[model samples]
Target: ETVIYRIYYYINRSGTGHLTLRELKRGNLIDAMLHCDEEEDINKVLRYFSYEHFYVIYCKFWELDTDHDFLIDKENLIRYGNHALTYRIVDRIFSQVPRKFTSKVEGNMGYEDFVYFILAEEDKSSEPSLEYWFKCIDLDGNGVLTRNEMQFFYEEQLHRMECMAQEPVLFEDILCQMIDMIKPQLVKTDYFTCLTIEISCLQDESYIMLRDLKGSKLSGSVFNILFNLNKFMAFETRDPFLIRQERENPTLTEWDRFAHREYIRLSMEDDVEDASNGSAEVWDESLEAPF
Candidate 1:
């Protein structure tokens, strides 16, 4: 309990004690963490802080398990045809998770897999997440992403960008940019140091929003579609009733912080409504037997 609060404090604004949709709309987790000098050290802190999202992730797992069969099928992921959830993103997910780890050949994901997907999406800097995506990007499973594999993902990204009628980006230029970001240091590089910097910038100063880069929609979304949705809600949505409004530090990843706050908000609303309804029921049954 104490540990969770300690983590939650750093992950959220201190005055608010947890993230609010308002603060998230202004910026993202990186903005909060970068107020400090060392991003690499902040990344390390985030890796051990997964426990901060334990509650929301558990709640969401069951929510995605539509069949009550203790698994999330492709149909579950495609729920209601939400436009932000693209087919390519969902398809790649099943293709990546090992068959042995999945619940069925039909590509159903169990709770553990769902958690891995969320962690990978929310904290690409984490070792578990970095390796999880490495497995996916390394389609051939030969321990590295070959030219063909890069082409494969890039082709889909290009197609999606074109379909959206956004200006097309020259594949060559994008490739050069990616190469530099992924392997910036030729000697003793931390490898993933800046790889995720551009790919998973969920803060308001996002690489996508800043550069307005085409196909950046799924730059990291192919790894998890919900990631994009969380960003949309955090950055685009405003507080309807002017709820709690303040800011401090950012400890949780933007997606994790967003989901956690949404869960708490909905839960509190339910409690208030339930209490009123219970009181009304008691008054109406006042004449009935207590037994």
Candidate 2:
């Protein structure tokens, strides 16, 4: 780690021993590492840096910054979408987790906060990213999610599902689905009742919750995707402007893997359809025309 740090210090070029968010946005991290002394190829560890991932993230931050203030306010996000998906994204982003205080408004996010948010959103299984989300969802900053906070987002989703469904889906059914995925140890439902969500997915209710898990977090992005994900499928329909997940080695998140599996599934489906169609055509034209 020390050797890598030394190499990174020189690669920083700013002589500050740290790579600023601006430095990342401007160009690729590996490109900078390549310029390092040719004697040792520091770029070998490029996979560890997530050079491309950070670039995409920086670009996204720039896009959403809108006013160029290097920050995103709730107004800007709400304008991003008035729908349930947007509401949940906004809710999680502005959760009561403590920050350095970039905005006085209820839920504004600066670049640093945005970076973690994107990371967790991109990779649900990441322990670190999960923790970042947990902080946001833990509105009371009590290290656990309360009923009010969870319902605030769930209710919006309920209204949304209702509009899209041919039939009404009770909150309990949704909870059951969510419980299967999130598997919150203590199942508290009744819609109006305060909900307490432990971050872990353990089946045992008496077991330790996610908050108690070392380096644990629960981001809204992951929850939204998981809640709607059907087996290996989860469409990122919530955020139209959501940043594309970078596929660099070691950077592939659970979502990425799932998407890849889904892609294979689709490809197989297409192949089967084409084969069936070809067989039908062959049978139909079993006898050639007079020519």
Off by over 4 Å in 2: 1-48, 78-84, 95-98, 101-108, 139-142, 146-149, 164-168, 182-208, 211-222, 225-251, 255-291
Q: Tens digit of lDDT per residue, candidate 1, span 1-291?
A: 322332332343333456667655543355444533454443233432333345456556556665556578777875522434445556767775422343554567766566556655555443334455555655546444444555565665566557878665555665555544443222223225434332223221212111221223333433332223433333334454322332333444445555556568657855887878755223233332111
Instruction: Write model 2 residue lDDT over 13-123, tens digit each, in one string.
Output: 453547877756654555545544342543233333423333344545555667766568766655431222346646556663523344554456766555445445556
TM-scores, one per candidate:
0.50, 0.49
Q: List the residue pairs that clash in candidate 2.
A: 130-217, 131-217, 134-218, 147-195
Model 2 CA lDDT for position 231? 17
Residue 228 in candidate 2 has what lDDT? Answer: 26
User: What Cα-based lDDT does every candidate model obtain?
Assistant: 0.47, 0.46
TM-score of 1: 0.50
Q: What ranges in model 1 sit over 4 Å off? A: 1-52, 78-89, 96-99, 102-106, 184-261, 264-291
How accurate locally is residue 220 in candidate 1, as Cα lDDT from 0 to 100? 45
